[model samples]
Target chain A: MNDTIGITALVPPELMYACGKRPLDVNNVVPVSSSSPSNKLCAWTAIWRDMILNGGLDIDSLVVVAGGDCHNALVDGQKAELSGMPTHYFFYPFDGDTDYLRSQLEKLVRFLGGIQDERMFSLISDLKAKGRALDELRVNDRARGSDVFSALISFSDLAGNPDIFGKTLDSVPRTDIRYSSRVALIGVPPIYPDFHETAEGFGLHVVYDELPYEFLRLGGSSLDSLASSYRDYSFAGPLKNRVRLIQDELLRRRVDGVIHYTQYACHHTLEDEIFRQHLDYPILTVQGDLPRPSTEQLKLRLEAFAEMLGVMS
Target chain B: MNIGLDVGSTTAKIVHVEEREVIFSKVVPSHHWTELIDDGQDDRCIVSTGYFRKKVPHCAAITEITAASLGARYHNPETQVIIDIGGQDTKVIDLRSNTFVINDKCSAGTGAFLELAAHYFDIPVGSLGRLHSLATKGAQLNNTCGVFAISEMISQLVSGYSMEEVIYGLHQAFALKISQMVPSADTVMLIGGTVRNTGIIDAINNVLDSKIEVPGAPQLVNALGAALYRERLDDGR
Candidate 1:
């Protein structure tokens, strides 16, 4: 169970994943919404602005947490530094090593206690089961249809609670839509939900999302197996490894094209040339600002990319 | 005759081709593309591209990136790169690989940025060429957004900087933004309505320190590419 935290710790809900409870999220301070010119991301800016306008924030400990890779994480750190908050910055080592990852997990475990609780084991089991259930839907040979879309949108929503997640997945509505091309989206998770809608509108069904959010993908049988899975997972460290993972999946899933979503001011999005160079398939890099839906430009590009990939008009 | 219409945000361009030869081409103030279409002319198979691409009904719709590459290939089969700096957006195409990189959601890297900056300087748009020819040093301007850039230019003007120095700086800034996107490359074939500005062309040439060619009828390249797409599809048929 200690291995579970060691594996999935770097991506999101960062260091506190070992605590076996939801971490404090500053993101909930306000709902991210739209603005003109589209690049002035309204996420944290609005929260701080609103708080100041409403006469100062009433908080004790504000800690910015990130997996310590890419600019979004750096931005979180910068925001913390600017706010003078106690922040946790976890720098991911370039060389993929279990020892490096486990050190952070150990520090976190000591800080928060609960090193070996039976609940953690049960949690892992339940999570693994839920993860398997989500993967099963990816195949969609069983008429799970549009529930797949809702299921994807809600994967993070229902990940922690295993009890009703299965029941909820069963009850969601399903509608089958024709997809002309199969696509994979990498880089930053979209700023707007309509990002997904736009791709579907362009007749490109997104089969693989490389963002760490939606599938925990705790792929292994035992604790050691889980750690091995993490060791093999390339998204953790080097660019070459991440590209390898994406390239393998592209061939395995038979993807037609790739739509990479990159946020402005983010490092990962800026250095998309590596991904483009490594991936043998056609790639369209979509750079957008936060709090805005898929723009007309992106839609036009998507339509063009889809057409270029031979999607039937 | 195959008609290709590039419907941009502020202007519309049309290219008429017959038997793979461009017979007629023109750009007009574009409120509507159908206005450019000759009355009762349905014999021409129309193709559309650019900003208002969806508004124009056509048999085939190509993206500016695809159209640029197709048009560049038609011009130079050995074409390696095409940089299009238009009013709406700037796109850098790696024609050899058929890959494209568009700038972030900002007008900073486009000709519109220069135009906006030029407007703030109160230099008549047509006189920019003569002004550029007379200017020597480019004053460093840091603001990337056109809106903020105007304020920055105002500050420079108040700070005892010559207007020519500032205007030269603005042109260099425009070229620098594009150079950042292209990073390193050989001679870049330039296209778009923005390329007609000789002042900007000189600035880009100085900044890049490399050869830049403006293919004849630069603005109509996309429209011709749209027509070429129809030509390819027709050939395939």
Candidate 2:
């Protein structure tokens, strides 16, 4: 079998070349598969559970990048293990220093069955190539001060495919999208593909934030990691980190506004609510789910809020 | 006017029933039941309910929240379940025939959680729900207990999640917590102060995966139901 087993939410392209494993994103598999067994849980929970139950979740190892509060993935992993499956949880802490990320990758490699010397070399080369490509694209899209609203759309499209992310970055017109105000996309990373695009269409520039990619990184101070290790629940670290991430985004961005998207019943939106009030600029709150105040209602509310900001400005 | 006065821990509500129809209603603070007596609006048969049932001045009779709950259901015989999430406590009433059984022993996952969160945020409790419309993204809270929720809210604040998200999360957590209390039967109705918070309603709908009836002026349904009960009794006696 040429395919080494791995599970991912959104596939990071380097994983395929570096590890020689087929990156299986469970979300993609579940839509095409059967989910009758997951009726006991809520609709959202059922979607992920069906992914696991149908063997779409078969992975020799799991690498969860930080973002999108992957509670669905982790919960499904627990259920899978109970039903007999091999899995591991990895944190991509937000610190961004590659050393800790590399070590964490090393541990994952060993756990998955040792990174061969040749494979390690290939992996580094793969990361370098991907990094270079990303940098070039980022530079060309350097119309940074230009309307960054489209960059958000490009970012939203980037969720599922790195190649598409690369391509979408290339396609965003360098037209002068006059710099409006800068805002932060706060709360439970956008796992959904069109989230950024939807927000960007509303004439706001969103810097990526409080996402799994940003919060789930494994490079935080060892003190926090050590603290998490002593905790009884697997979700404790992620939960605590989420609060920290939102705070950091608020401080770092000098953000003019915040757009909070939280899943209903997540209990995390409480933090964002408090944060929204303290911000000097306007804040737009969006509660996401399949039902209730429908998308149209949310859009109207957001538009009205943006108009209110326009009036005040 | 046949009036049913419900003296709650925080608010006093009175419904004026004339010939089986409620003509007017007043909600005042529990401390101001004397204000109703001071108005010189007497000669009306009074039925009282709520935590401070004994406090209603010139009341002809008093009943518990459970009795009022049952009375409300009796008025609307079609009501299968009654949910009351108030300031200090939460009630999940299972209405069967004419009897209503209440879950009043626990205050951990009720509207007290909201009050605790509001105090922690130091905002007027009435103003909490208005912030949901302003949120674009929200942070989540993880408080399962009412008393300890204050500490959890504080931790979330220190950690940097916005107060709106914390409040929304508290409601979401509550909906999830209360969902298990819902009977398998349908037509569940929500009552009490928490019903005024749409965020909680959305959260509950998310958990129940179905729409529950929330009448207009939902907070007054219990008092209205009490008034209807007095109307029936006065005609019979």
Question: For each candidate, what TM-score against the reference?
Answer: 0.77, 0.42
How big is the positional error of residue B198 in model 2, measured in Å on the Cα after superposition?
21
Residues A89-146, candidate 2, lDDT per residue (tens digit)?
6654444434554565556656555433344333333333443343333223343322
- lDDT (tens digit, per residue) of candidate 1 on A1-313: 2222111123222223335444333333222533232223434343443342333444333333345444344554455456654444554445756676556545444544543333444544465465455544553433232345445433332443445655765665444546777788887566655676687776777776775322455333333443444555455467777787788878876788787887656567655889877888778888765555667778877877776676212
Candidate of highest DockQ: 1
Give the 10-residue window scoring lowest on summed lDDT in candidate 1 chain B.
B95-104
lDDT of candidate 1 over B77-144, digit per residue (tens): 66677888878688887755546777646788776776776677666666666676777776788746
Q: What is the TM-score of chain B alone in each candidate?
A: 0.92, 0.85
Q: For candidate 1, give the lDDT of residue A76.
A: 40
Clashes of each: 0, 51
Error of 1 at B123 (Å): 4.3
Overall lDDT per candidate, in order of appearance: 0.64, 0.53
Q: Over the full model, what C-alpha lDDT does candidate 2 score relative to the true structure?
A: 0.53
State the TM-score for model 2.
Answer: 0.42
Give native contacts recovered, as a fraction, per prediction: 0.36, 0.00
* Pairs of residues clashing in candidate 1: none
